[model samples]
Target: MSVHEEISKKTNKTWGIIQTYRKLDEKREAEIEKVILQCQNNEAFSVDQINKVTEEINSFAAINHLPSRKFVTKQMVEEAAQN
Candidate 1:
């Protein structure tokens, strides 16, 4: 597959996984977050832990298509507000 196609496939997979997680009860989401936090707090992360974190982070990131608000300038916000 081409690079673009490969990336699209991976993104779709991540999005599907995230949607599955969302469909679960909220408690499960909280539990998963707790586990993620625990894994992250370890001094050294295992390869599996790293991979899981990376996947979840990427999946969460895929939820948004817009650029980060951190990059928004005061002028940009003012202009937007004026509209």
Candidate 2:
């Protein structure tokens, strides 16, 4: 391939990464909301429950190579659910 073609290919790849990052960020926020709602309806709101949800999200992020949202504690869930 020509130098110009190679540069264009890399530019497209960079753009794809940016778009994927944006989409993943939005998805992560939605996932957090879903987790909070699940906890709100559950019988008990505990640290373990929060940790389980956090781990699930983090695992998903890991697979996607996105930064994990650490420290999703029970208190954060409780406060977010109220809003």
Candidate 3:
């Protein structure tokens, strides 16, 4: 899968886990923070340093916010236009 697809899948799964936990709230807690912790523990994502960093950055802002847009260079766009 592409990076965008993977990010979307992870984002959705994170939301699903958070929602499920919300319904079973026996004790009140920071739901978003809890979900992020659970995601951080997953072996599929935590094994690679780069992946872990990306996951943490995205997960920490998954709720009530969006990831900041990255700057694109003119050369980057021109290169893409050549494809």
In terms of TM-score, which candidate is strongest? 2
**Global lDDT of model 3:** 0.44
Every model's TM-score? 0.31, 0.52, 0.31
Tens-digit lDDT track for model 3 on 1-83? 89999999999987976664444332222333343454545422122333334454445446536452223333433343344
Ranking by lDDT: 2, 1, 3
Candidate 3 ranges beyond 4 A from true positions: 26-83
Q: After superposition, how far is residue 46 of candidate 2 from its true place, in Å?
A: 8.2
Between prediction 2 and prediction 3, the one with superior TM-score is: 2
Candidates ranked by TM-score, best first?
Answer: 2, 1, 3
**Overall lDDT per candidate, in order of appearance:** 0.47, 0.68, 0.44
C-alpha lDDT of residue 37 in model 2: 76
Candidate 3 is scored at a TM of 0.31
What does candidate 2 score in Cα RMSD to the true structure?
4.7
Q: Tens-digit lDDT track for model 1 on 1-83?
A: 89999999999987886665554324334444444454455432223433444455445545644211122233433344344
Candidate 3, RMSD to the unseen true structure: 19.1
lDDT (10s digit) by residue, model 2, range 1-83: 99999999999977886676666556656666777877778745445544555566567667757677665676788788778
| Candidate 3: residue pairs that collide | none
